[model samples]
Target: MISQSAGKIFLAEERGHNELNWFRSFNTFNFGSFYNEHKHPFESLYILNEDTLAGNRKISMLAENDSCIVLIPVVGAISFKDSAGNSGLLQAGQAQVLNVYAGTTLEISNPYEEESVNFLQIWIKTPDLQSTVPQLFEFDLDKNPNQLLELFSPQKKTLVKTVPQPHGVIGKFSGRSEAVYNPAQSGNALFAYVIEGNVEVQYRLMNPRDGLGLWDLEEMELEALSENAIVLILEIPVLKTV
Candidate 1:
């Protein structure tokens, strides 16, 4: 049995909120002015921000060196353009990853006329920068229900492999459905986020927007508590503190 000491739960309500006239964001870690010493980067998983943009609204962010940025649209399509001359639209069922250098300005905007768009922006620190272009992965949850669908894997040639690669998966399960996840690499950590419905991970209940981090375990079990429950799991390598 995996001990409870290997898990840490982060409640949704405890997240930092930044609201403006056209943009609203809930940060799970230190981002912008929302700094929490207790909420530091979970291993190499640096940032996880849930952002909502009003119609025709836009926001810009500067990229850090030796980092990878991943964007997942949750509600509506979002248009993005980076200073490196890359631009595209990310739909609800799609995920995009881009290895960016320092000082790259990324502009993300809601393309809808009257509807708001919600998306998740995740940042991961890499050992070194790689010369790779932006890549998009699309998956349909309805196509394969009650199973984990892999969204991103480090095995791709486009991804940097200077260090242990991170893997990402998304799953949709019905009530009473059960699933298990085993990390591809040893000594890696797992971070699970509830996207739509409630779920129980390793005996801990989690609501929508809640996140749970676990380490020092070989595998973890998950069970959906509601219909059409969606969860995002990231297998991140444990990095040593410098």
Candidate 2:
């Protein structure tokens, strides 16, 4: 049985950095400053790191073809050139997802040439996909039409679904509507993690990084105004086999 802490935050850190093996790297945890702490992973715990790179610097001989890698820019534009001679630039409003299985090399640099670039890189076990070419999908905060981003199960086209069916849904909320979530099924477990700002959720005060877990509830309410509250929501099936 998964512990109640399963939906809890095991780690949380602000923007920070350090150097390793002659390579300067940024990470969410100060522990990364020590080389030995750089390697750690669990069955469900994949790779999670927020990184920033200086101009013309190279770290981690990352291949373009690695099971599954996603790069999301939070600040400056990140310049990238892959093994297949593929090149592109990712900015704050963009995210690049690659499935590197056919052999691909990647070289990322500061897009500004003089300034640095920062982004979040998460590596999860790719679902059983026989053939998945690197796919790039640009997301603009304005594209939501209502300023909302939709992430569903990669297994399903809509509704948040994880590759492993993830057992839950995870996302952020940053608006007035609160992204009404209603699970049509029972035994669904859900929770929300505040990333930044505050929100008057269900009349309760939620500050940055604060999280609340909920289960056995079919519907929950969220509303925010005055401040753009950023929240990470996770929904899971309490009992199911995938």
Best by lDDT: 1
**Cα lDDT tens digits for candidate 2, 62-85:** 532234556677678777776655
TM-score of 1: 0.94
Model 2, residue 102: C-alpha shift (Å): 9.6
- Candidate 1, residues 1-242, lDDT tens digits: the string is 74574777778898989999889999988888898777888888988999999999899998775667889999999999998888899999999887777788989999999999999998888665555577788899999999999887763563444457777999999999999998877777999999999999988999999999999878889999999999999988778776
TM-score per prediction, in order, is: 0.94, 0.60
Model 2 TM-score? 0.60
User: What RMSD does model 2 have?
Assistant: 6.5
Per model, how many backbone clashes are there? 0, 10
Off by over 4 Å in 2: 1-6, 14-45, 61-66, 84-86, 102-105, 142-147, 151-177, 180-195, 198-226, 231-242
